[model samples]
Target: MREISLDRLRTLVAIADCGSFADAARALHLAPPTISLHIADLEERFGAPLLSRKRGQVRPSAVGETLVKYARRLLAEAEQALQDVKRQVEGKGGRVRLGASTGAIANLLPRALELLALHHPGIDLQIAVLTSQETLARLKSGALDVGLVALPQQATDGLTIKRWRRDPVMAFMPAGWKCPARVTPQWLAVRPLILNDSSTRFSRLTAEWFASGGQHPVPRIQLNFTDAIRSLVAAGYGAALLPQEAVAPVQDPRIAMRPLRPALWRELGIAHSAEDIDRPTQHVLDALWSLRLR
Candidate 1:
């Protein structure tokens, strides 16, 4: 029997994640036939079917489920091996893959990246905009060098997390709306709301805060992006609860912001794999720390 190739394992994992050959091919930038052939080859070597296709949907067989679990682990290790070799030769000049939540990217990370660019010109930076959960998953899988995430209440194992900054959540109201000096949960609940989509950590945090007060603020518009939420608020659609940094870029005169009473705040932080900190990762961390101090 032939040994399974790294390429085949990678394809299997992608297929398992993406749920179909066409989708997996798109994700891996390979043709559908290529992905099918790779999976077929792997099954041939193992002498067991890896996937079951029924009614145009693909499900992993029992053997496929077991293989996928091991395949993901092997692929993660292989990627780490390449990163390790690159780090040895490149030192601080290697590429750093960083991920950030939308709120952090609006202000915090751009400033840190500018500082990193000035100090380490040789280090190439690749930035990904992702939700907090996605950022954590990428960091754990060795897919990201470092991540800027909203600090969770409980820390995950095998990760080093440092508090970067605290950003207050504010209510954005229309220009003529009469808002108190300090808005309360009761006041916010009465206003027409334009809320962040339920998927984001920010949305969950906001929801929990309101729920704590026994109020459910119904949103007329549910937005996924921070900018879109700002636009809706500015257009007089409804008020929104967002991080202070997220609304910094908007200069619309139609919207006014008021601080919430008891001051809800979100903590942003830098997180990286505890076991895999390399020169490039350290360099970026140093830059971020310097920015924090400034």
Candidate 2:
């Protein structure tokens, strides 16, 4: 059986509205013969006389009335669907998935999110906390739209990684310590240390910095979360080497920060699939790029 087209539905509805074929043809901007053919095709498909003539006026049969009622709803929904697609095309509304480290989420992503909301309020961002390796993996598997990842990552196929930010790593210590204005790796090595887990890129960066100073020290404890490491440092448990974000909290009375002498930096990069990026993802990338340090 042939499916009924919306054109035929519209003709039936117009006939019911104007109570005549001539007015429906003018209202639809179609010829009177085309309107008649449209109704004839619809009636033939349903095997029913869809129009009844009474008092020299054209009126819809019961079947035509039922179709007109449902056609109005379908037309309205089609128009709404078109509006939604247009909004997405204009970068006015869409959903984007992003993945980042806990530190990035805590110290960096909020600013980018704020910028995105300020400019593109209709863009819905779904954020996930993940390691750099996990983020890259998800990007390859089509689970993520964009990622804020630790830098110095090797080239990967089907991915585009661009340097995002470089934040100086600093020594975070309990305020009671008589810490120097600038901390050398040797000076920090001798103190009881709390460090990122050995698996993290940050841990490797700190290790290399210590090695450059000819001092290899064992951490008293290792944790994956930067926030947890800072909490331990605030408790005077041990000192930690962590990136000092530009917007990092400055009013913590118990924790003190000092720049590193050799000036080790934790670098971050934006990564996404090499395929053509959609408007929502492009907007998110633009927000992150705006936050990049000069």
Best by TM-score: 2
For candidate 1, give the lDDT of residue 243. 80
Question: lDDT of each model, Cα atoms only?
Answer: 0.83, 0.91
- Single out the weakest 10-residue window by summed lDDT for candidate 2: 243-252
The pairs that clash in candidate 1 are: none
Give candidate 1 regions above 4 Å deviation.
1-92, 246-251
lDDT (Cα, tens digit) per residue for candidate 1, span 197-289: 888877888888888778987778787777778878888888998888642565579998999876898878888888957777888888877
**How many backbone clashes can be found in candidate 2?**
0
User: Global lDDT for candidate 2?
Assistant: 0.91
Kindly list the per-residue Cα lDDT of model 2 for residues 101-172, writing each as its tens digit.
888998788888899989999999999988899999999999999999999899989999999999889899
- Report lDDT (Cα) of residue 150, candidate 1: 75
TM-score of each: 0.66, 0.76
